[model samples]
Every structure is written in C-alpha cells, then in structure tokens.
Target: MTNREKYNQAFIETLEITADQLGDDLTYQSIEAWDSVGHMQLVSALEDAFDIMMDTDDIIDLSSYPLGIEILKKYDVEFS
Candidate 1:
C-alpha cells in the first residue's frame, strides 16, 4: 500500500471508522471510538506503519486528521 493508504488504514482500523468518515473534521474525541485509548491505538498504528517513533509532543499535537498528515511529515513520511 502507498503511504496515504497506510496512513488512512491506521486511522480506519484503529478507530473502527469508515474511509468516508475520515477528514479534517475528524479529531480526538470527535467520535465515540476515538477516546484516549483509541488515540494511543492510532499512534501505535501510525508508528508501526511508518516505522518511526513519534515524540510525546507530536502525539499530543496529533489532535486532528489533517494535522496527523502534517505531523507525519516531520518524520519524512511523505504523502505524495
């Protein structure tokens, strides 16, 4: 899968959400499944998918879907 696919997959599988549900509006606690536990699940998924360890601040700052893309960029996980 591509980087974008992997990224989306991480969110999808971690949060038990559909593809269409993903967007800028998707943020932490925005859905019933995206609680603190889900957030860590997502972070773990992203780290495993990208093979990079996100810093503590980065994890805390990953409050939204769009921002997650930007945060991953800091680790050189390009989308395009």
Candidate 2:
C-alpha cells in the first residue's frame, strides 16, 4: 500500500472507523473511538506501517487527521 493508504488503514483499524469517516474534522476527543487509548493505537499503527518512530512532541501534536498527515511528513512519509 502507498503511504496514503497505510495512513488511512491506521486510522481505520485504530479508530474502528471507515475510510469515509476520515477527514480534517476527525480529531482526537472528537469521537468516542478516538480516546487516549485509540490515539496510541493509531500512533503505534502508523509507526509500524511506516517503520519510523515518532517523537513525544509529534505524538502530542498529532491531534487531528490532517495534523497526523503533517507529522508523518516530517518523518518523510509522504501522503501522495
């Protein structure tokens, strides 16, 4: 899968959400499934999928779907 596909998959599996549900509005604490536990799950999924570890600051800053894409880009995980 491409980076975009893997990114979507992480959110899908971690949030127990559908691909259609992902968007800029999808954020941490914005939904029942995106609690602290779910956030870590998503982080783990992304790390594993991208083969890169994220810094604590990056993890905390990744508060939204759009922001997550930005954070990953810092690690060279291009979306397109």
Candidate 3:
C-alpha cells in the first residue's frame, strides 16, 4: 500500500472508523472515536505501520490527519 493508504488504514484500524469517514479535516477530538485513548492507539498504530518510533513531540504534534503526513515525512515517509 502507498503511504496515503497506510496512513488511512492506521486511522481506520486505530479509530475503528470506516475509510469513508476519514479526511484531512479529521482531527484529534474531532469525533467521539478519536479521544485521548484513541489518539495513543493511533500513535501506536502509525508507529507499527510506518516502522518508526516517533518522538514525543511528533506524537503530540500529530493533531490532525493532514498533519500526520507532514510529521511522517520528517521520518522519511513519502506519500504518493
């Protein structure tokens, strides 16, 4: 899967949401499913999916779906 697909899948699995429900507008606490607990789950899922350990700052800075791409790019994760 491409990086975009992997990113979406991480959110899908971690947030227990459908793919159709995800978007750039999707942010932390934007939905009931993306609460504090869900945020950490997403962090873990993204780490597992991308095979990289994110710094605490990056993890905390990942406040939105679009921001995720930017943050992941710092780890050399390219999106297509």
Candidate 4:
C-alpha cells in the first residue's frame, strides 16, 4: 500500500476510528479512543508502517492528523 494508505490504515487500527473520522479537528484529546495509550499506539504504528523512528520532538508535535503528516514528511516519507 501507499504511504497515505498505510498512514490512514494505521490511524484507523490504532485509534479504532474510521477514515471519515480522521482530520485536523479529530485531535488526540478530541476523540474518545485517542487517549494516551492510543497516542503511543499510533506513534508505534506510524513508525512501523513508515519504517522510521520518530524523535521526542516529533512525537510531541504530532498532536493532530496534519501534524502527523508533517512529522512523517520530516522522516522522508512521501505522502503522495
């Protein structure tokens, strides 16, 4: 699968959310399933899916979907 597809799938699986439910507005604290545990799961999932380990700064900055994409891009992950 593509990077976007993998990211979307990881989000869905880790957060137990639907594709339609993912967006900038759907932040970590905004969703029921996006708690601390889910946040770590998402980080792990994204790392595994993209084969890139994230730094603490990136992890802290990944507070939203858009931020996650940006963070992945910093690791040389092409979204398209």
Candidate 5:
C-alpha cells in the first residue's frame, strides 16, 4: 500500500475516525476519540505501519495530522 493509504488506515483504525474526518488540520483536541491514550495508539500504529521508530521529539511534536506527516518524512517515509 501507498504511504497515504497506510496513513489513512492507521488513522482510521487507531482513531476510530472516518476518512472525511481526517486531514492536515486534524488535532488531538479536535476529536473526542483522540485523547492521550489514543495519541499513544496513534504513535504505535504509525510506527508499526511505517516500520519506523520515532524519537521522543517526534512523538511529542506530532500534534496534528500534517505534523505527523512531516515527522514521518524525517524517518524517510515519502508522502508521494
């Protein structure tokens, strides 16, 4: 699967959110399901999906969907 597909699947499965609800603007505080526990789940899901280990900085800085994409790119995950 593509990066976008992987990202979407991870977000959907971990966040329990629909495709329409996901976007670069999506933030932890923006959704009821994206609490602290869900944040950790999201981090784990992203790591598992991308097969990349994230640093504490990346984990803490991944505050939004766009930021997540940016951080993942640092791990060599091409968005395209």
Candidate 6:
C-alpha cells in the first residue's frame, strides 16, 4: 500500500472507523472514537505503519489529518 493508504488505515483501524470517514476535517476529540486512548493507539498505528518513531512533541502536535501529514513529513514520510 501507499504511504497515504497506510496513513488512512492507521486512522481507520485505530479509530474503528470506515475509510469513507477519513478527511481533512478529521481531528482529535472530534469523534467518539478519537478520545485520548484512541489518540495513542492511532499514534502507535502510524509509527508501525511508517516504521518511524515520532517524538512526543509530534505525537502531541498531530491533532488533525492535515497536520499528521506534516508531522510525518518531518520523519521523511512522503505522501506521494
């Protein structure tokens, strides 16, 4: 799968949501499934999917879908 797909899957599987629910509007605490625990799970999933260890600051900074992409970029994960 592509990096984008891996990213989406991290959110989808971690949050127990469907791919159709993924979007730029997706943000932490925006859904019942994305609470504090879910946030850590999503962070773990992203780390596993991208094979990168994110700093605590980045994990905390990843509050939105668009921002996640930016944070991943800091680790050299390219979407395209």
TM-score to native of every candidate shown: 0.98, 0.96, 0.94, 0.95, 0.95, 0.96
For 1-80, candidate 5 gives per-residue lDDT tens digits of: 89989998989999998999888779977898888999999999999999988999888998998888889989999998
- Model 2 Cα lDDT, one tens digit per residue, 1-80: 78899999999988999988999899999999999998999899999999999999999999999999999999988877
lDDT of 3: 0.92
Candidate 4 C-alpha error for residue 52, in Å: 1.0
Write one digit per residue (lDDT tens) for candidate 3, span 1-80: 88889999999988988987888779999999899899999999999999999999998999998899999999999997
Alpha-carbon RMSD, each predicted model: 0.5, 0.6, 0.8, 0.8, 0.8, 0.7
Identify the candidate with maximal lDDT.
1
Model 1's number of clashes is 0
Q: Number of clashing residue pairs in every model? A: 0, 0, 0, 0, 0, 0
Candidate 4 deviates by what RMSD?
0.8
lDDT of each: 0.97, 0.93, 0.92, 0.89, 0.90, 0.93
Q: Point out where model 6 deviates above 4 Å.
A: none
Which candidate achieves the best TM-score against the true structure? 1
Model 5 misplaced regions, further than 4 Å:
none
> Candidate 5: deviation at residue 63, Å?
0.6
Q: Rate residue 22 of model 1 by lDDT.
A: 95
Residue pairs with clashing backbones, model 5: none
- What's the C-alpha lDDT at position 66 in model 5? 81
Clash count for candidate 4 is: 0
Using TM-score as the measure, name the better of candidate 5 and candidate 6: 6
lDDT for residue 39 in candidate 1, whole number 0-100: 96
